[model samples]
Target: MASSNQQVPYGYEPPQSNVRGTLIYYDDFNDITDAALEQAAIVAEQMRFAKLVLYPLHEQTVRRISNEQVAPFYKREQRLQEWKLDSGRKSILVEGWDGKRKKYTPIEAAIRTCMDHYSSPYFLLMTPEMANRFASFATFEEWITKISLVLTRQPDHLHPRMETFRSRWRVAGEQRDKNGKQSEL
Candidate 1:
């Protein structure tokens, strides 16, 4: 470690991070395709995130949250692992908290855990359907201010809360121009 007394070269400065924050892909991963994975990776890279964390919900959690049935968690997680390896993305990480708990994990708990572990300014990458579902939850208002949302695409319909907090979210492939107008990337 460099001491406080250590002097830097006259024209040199310490390295600073160009990448910022974490992009968390929060989903069940039951119907995610390889193309979707690529889109997520592309988003993370484009946004210059420090990491891309795939937080797959457990089957019970999915059932509780969305009232949808899904395949076993292991199968889904293994598939994600395989994809990560095949894609050769060093910054991609598969979070296993829900898998290890083996129970219905609440969205609030999941988000809190992620916030505790990852860097600040978190952005949740989710499909439009999932984003709408999340907005319908009771804790949506509380969480919305804590982190931003990046939907996979523009939603055909929006939850009332989502509509109310429109500024807190953006479409994944859309970026703001110099004048603050959104344009497709």
Candidate 2:
């Protein structure tokens, strides 16, 4: 039997999207510079991600993960806002879900929330140290395969798991070899 196709109205075709995936910048934002934020945005644009989410970790979350002291969450968020305004980038988003909770938010929860709210193919952007700390988490192996890592820069040292999963990550602005050494692009 032949199937008949129904004609659709002009200009009413299904919506199409050129971009694919979300680039989530998850960090404490204590010492993040405007330059670093710009780099992340640039990376997102270059990769053609639909959105660049700046997911700032609350102070408690920072302490639990790395015992590092961070400025108040409000202050950090304000800084992010200022950068967003100055950069005038509409695709940038500063997520405050963790701040609203006012306590430590596990990596698992943070990633899950992002997954639920954002588009597929999530890529986590973080500093070298933060990436290492995330690798130490029990859920690292489970989540690593689900999402890719984008380190601000290659780390001087590597966590064992990071080493084992080296193929799962890359430097933001440059390419590197298997040993984490800079390689020609």
Candidate 3:
């Protein structure tokens, strides 16, 4: 029994208690293998049946192996120079080197090998039924409310790595703030 004047949270519809229609979801294409595409398809199907839409997003296919793989090609002494030039600064670099040589695990090596040879495909899947259901919403705000609700309920639809990366980034930011406060004192 909330009042009309009360503000509603983003992606949440005030009048409607349940979410409906096809909701758009975005997922990154890290490695476009059969397994990866199959997973995307399965998630898409699950979402579609649940009355949600998924739109996987990929910026571009990484054409080369990550920097860690290529680091061995360059001389150890020249690593920093190469990094400053172009070798290690590429977007394909996932986990960067820690300034010390470290052994890569078998799984890591396998993933790098695959990335070196395969081209990642961008994924975007949506059903044709979306337009009809979307029209029922009165305003853009209402549509956003529905979309937000869908995303909130379906965490599995998101890219797992991205969430971990975001959490780490948040922790790092908090640590930086704490350090700055200590330095000022």
Candidate 4:
């Protein structure tokens, strides 16, 4: 939907035709359509029950999504480049490279050094009726012990269109997936 001529101070007022004879229902932050919002809502509900509703936001999340949700043997293959980090906290950085991939070039490991040490079990108290559970055991050995490897992989045989869904949605699309979908509601 194009912005209406009825411009307001902050931004353009949404055109009535785009809104379909309004009774203002709800709008997301950037003001995408209701159908988009509904699809998003459904995705969010699915994520709350699980995590599939949301797209991966971080580099590790990208790797995790690949391994658990899409690729079989994918470790977080993309590494982070060198930066002093926004916070002064010095983390044990681990560098790995993929000659074929582009993105975070060298991985900056979080403060938790899996190579040399493990985390102590830490807990979070979110609510009275419901709570969050996280396990922290020192060393990759313990962490790997508690985690189960997912059996899914990026099948080499999906239709070409299927390739888009496996990528990170946070950035501009350069892959087949980004140029593939129009995202209509």
How does each model score on TM-score?
0.93, 0.86, 0.21, 0.16
lDDT string, candidate 2, 89-158, tens digits: 8899999999999999999999999999999999999889999999998889999999999888869999
Better of 2 and 3 by lDDT: 2
Q: After superposition, how far is residue 141 of candidate 1 from its true place, in Å?
A: 1.0
On TM-score, the leading prediction is: 1
Candidate 1 lDDT by residue in tens digits, 1-185: 87578677898978998899999999999999999999999999999999999999999999987899999999999999999999999999999999999999988888899999999889999888889889988889999999999999889999999989988898998997777567998
- What's model 4's overall lDDT? 0.24
The window of 10 residues in a row where model 1 has the poorest summed lDDT is 176-185
Clashes of each: 0, 0, 2, 8
Shift of residue 160 alpha carbon in model 2, Å: 1.0
Q: Among these predicted structures, which one has the highest lDDT?
A: 1
Global fold similarity of model 4 (TM-score): 0.16
Question: How much is the lDDT of residue 42 in candidate 3?
Answer: 43
Error of model 1, residue 160, in angstroms: 1.2
Q: Whole-model lDDT for model 2 versus the true structure?
A: 0.91
Candidate 3 residues 86-177, lDDT tens each? 42222222222312323322222322333343333211132212221222334423333222222212232333332322222111011224
> Lowest lDDT 10-mer window, candidate 2?
176-185
Cα lDDT, all candidates: 0.92, 0.91, 0.28, 0.24
Once superposed on the true structure, which residue ranges of model 2 sit more than 4 Å away at CA?
A: 1-17, 175-185
